[model samples]
Target: MASRGVGAALAIAAAGLLAASALGKGWISAGSASVGLMGGEVCRGGKCKTLELPEKDGWRTTGTVAFAAALGAAGLGLVAGIMGLARKRSKVPAVLTLVAALAALGGGIAFILVAPGKGVMEHLAWGAYCGVGGGVFAVVGAILLMRAAGAGPSYAVGMPGTANPAARTLMLAETAKVSGPEAKTMAPGMAMAPQVQAPRPSKGAPAMVPPCPKCHGPLQFAGQFNAWYCPRCQSYLQV
Candidate 1:
C-alpha cells in the first residue's frame, strides 16, 4: 500500500513536470530568443522572429516533434498515476508509465542533439531540466508499481499446476534417532539404523498449499489440526 501511494505520487508529479516542459520555454537562442516544445523566437538586436507550429526552421521542427512526444508522455503518466492511486494491479499502468518515461527522455535528448546549426547559439534551459527530472520520476514510479503487484502461483517439478512442492510436506521433519541403548558402545563396523518416515499430515489432504492470506508467505499443512499453517504468522489458516 505504501509503495502504491509513493509510486502514484511520483507518477503524478512526473506528469505535471513533463507537461510544463513541453509547454514552457526550455531553451535559449540568439541571446534574447527562447524556445521550448511549443516553439521559440530568433532575435537579432531589437528584431525578433516568432516561431510557431507551422514554421519550417530546423530547431522549431525538432521542438514540434518533442512537443508531441512530451505531451503524450505526460498524458500517459497521469493515467498511470491515477491507476496506481486506485490500487489497481493492472500491468498496463506500469507498462504505460515506463513507455512514457522513454518517450519523454528520447524527445528531450533529440531536441538537444539535433537542435540547431549555422552559427545558432542554443543552450538548454529549465524546460529541458524538467523533462529529465520527469523522466527519472516516471521510471522510479513504474518500478515501484511493478514491485507492489502480486506474484502468480508457482508449480513444482512432476506435480500438477495446483501443487506446490513447499505445501506437500504435512508436518515438520521428525526423523527417528538411534540413541537409547548401546549407541555409546556401538562397534565401528556396525550398519546404521534405518530412518523412520514421518506420518502423513491428513487423510484427505490436498496436494496444493496456498500462500498465506495475511503476509503472502508459504503455508504448510498440519495433519494434527487438519489445517494449513503459516510459519511466518505462527497461526493456523482456515483455507
Candidate 2:
C-alpha cells in the first residue's frame, strides 16, 4: 500500500511538470519582443524581439513555479516512503505521502487552468493523470493507517479460540466452568446416588427420618456416609 502511494505521488508530480513545461513554452513564444522599462522583453508585432522576459505571466515564471510545486510534492512523497520503510510502527510517513500526492494533484489542476486555450486538452490530460495518482496515494495511505492502528489483519496469540490477553483469560474461565468440580456436582443422578443417601433407623424409631438438620426436610442416608443426609439441602450429619 505504501508503495502504491509513493508511485501515485510520483506520477502526479510528473504530470504537473509536463503540463507546466507546455505552458512555459507558450509563454516564451508570447514574450520574445521589445524591451520594457524593466529591461525585459514585451509582446510586440505578435512576437518578442528582445530576449529579456516579463516578470509576471512570463513563460519562465509559469513553468518554473509549476515544475517547482510538482517537484516539491514528489520530494515529500519520497521522504514519506523512506520514513515508512524505516519506521514499521508509525503511520505518519504514510499520511505524509498521501498529503504529498494531493498537493501534486492540486498543482496539476492549477497548471491546467493557467495553460493556453490550444493546450487545454494537454492540460486536462495532465490533470487526470495527477488525479489518478493522488487517488492511489490516498487509498494506499488509508490502508497503511488501518494496519498501523491494529484494525487490519489478525495477529492474536493465546488460546486456540481466543486472541489477546483478555481473551485468553476469558477462555480459561470458561474452560474451568465446563470442566471444574461444579460440573461434577451437576452431573446425572446416577453418579450422585451413592453420595446422597438416607439415614438408618434409630432404635425403636421409624426407619426414615422426617427432620433434616440443615432444612427440617426429610432426611436420608442410603449408605455412603452412614449419616443422616438432606436431599433438599444436600447436607450431611453423623448419626
Candidate 3:
C-alpha cells in the first residue's frame, strides 16, 4: 500500500516538475520582456522589471535544478516505500521517508525563490501544493512502515517480556497450584502439593478458550459464572 502511494506521488511530482520546466522554458523563449496595458495606455519592456524578479540569464538553469531536486526526492520516496512494504522488519524506510519529505520541502522553497514575475504566484502555489502533499505522504508512509515492522500503536501497551509464552505458562502453573487434603494425599509426604487439574473437556466441547481483554492473553476456565481469567496479568473476562 505504501509502495503504491509513493509511486503515485512520484508520478504526480514528475509531471509537475515537467510542467514547471516547460512553462519556464516557454517564458524564456517568449523574450524575457514584460508588457502591461491599462485603458488606452500601454507599458512595455525593461522598465517593468523588478529587483525581486529572477534573473533571465540563469533562470532556466535554476528551474532545471529545482526540477531535478523534486525528482530526486520523489525517487527516494518511492524507494523507501518499496523497502518498507517488502522488508516488513526494518525502520530504514521510515527514516528515508522523513529525509525525502525534507528534500521535497527544500526543493519547493528553491523553486519559489527562482521563479519569474509573471507566473511567480502560480509557480509558488504549485510548489507549496507539492511540498505539502509530499510531506503528508511521507509522514503517512513512515507510520505505515512502523506499523508493518510492529513498532507502533499495536504494541503500545508494553514490550515483549511480560507477554512471553514461557512467562505466561509459568504464571498459569503457579495459579493452578492446589492446597487441600486431596492435594496433600495425592503427593503423600511431599513438602509441596501438586495442582488440582481441571477435568478435560468432552469430545464435543469447544476447543478454543477465550482471551482476557486487558493483556490479550489466554484465560483459564472459571466454572461458576462461565468466565475466564488471565492469571499472569490478573485480568477477568466473560467466557
Number of the top TM-score candidate? 1
What are the Cα lDDT values of the candidates? 0.65, 0.45, 0.45
lDDT of 1 at 14: 88
Backbone clash tally (model 2): 14
Ordered by TM-score, highest first, the candidates read 1, 3, 2
Give the per-residue Cα lDDT of candidate 1 at 152: 24
lDDT score at residue 100, model 2, on the 0-100 scale = 53
Local accuracy of candidate 3 as per-residue lDDT tens digits, 96-128: 655655555555455555555665554333335
Pairs that collide in candidate 1 are: 201-223
Task: Give the alpha carbon lDDT tens digit for every residue of 1-239 in model 2.
Answer: 45434433443443344343323333212223222111334455676544543344453354345455445545554555444445344565455545654554555455444444464453233334444454355435534543543422333332354445466665556445434656434323422323433344554244656576456777664332234556786655444
Give, for candidate 2, the lowest lDDT window spanning 10 residues.
28-37
Alpha-carbon error at 156 in model 3, in Å?
11
By TM-score, the better pick of 2 and 3 is 3
The C-alpha local distance difference test score for the whole of candidate 1 amounts to 0.65
Error of 1 at 43 (Å): 7.6
Instruction: Go through the candidates in order and give the clash count of each.
Output: 1, 14, 0
Candidate 1 residue lDDT tens string, 1-239: 57778988888898898899888875544467777777767778889787663344465577777777777777877888888888677768778778768877877777776665554333667888888888889888877876665422221222323233344331211101112243333234433222222233445476666776667788787543334567887765432
Alpha-carbon shift of residue 130 in model 2 (angstroms): 6.7
Structural similarity to truth (TM-score) of each candidate: 0.57, 0.36, 0.42
- How far off is model 2, as Cα RMSD? 18.2
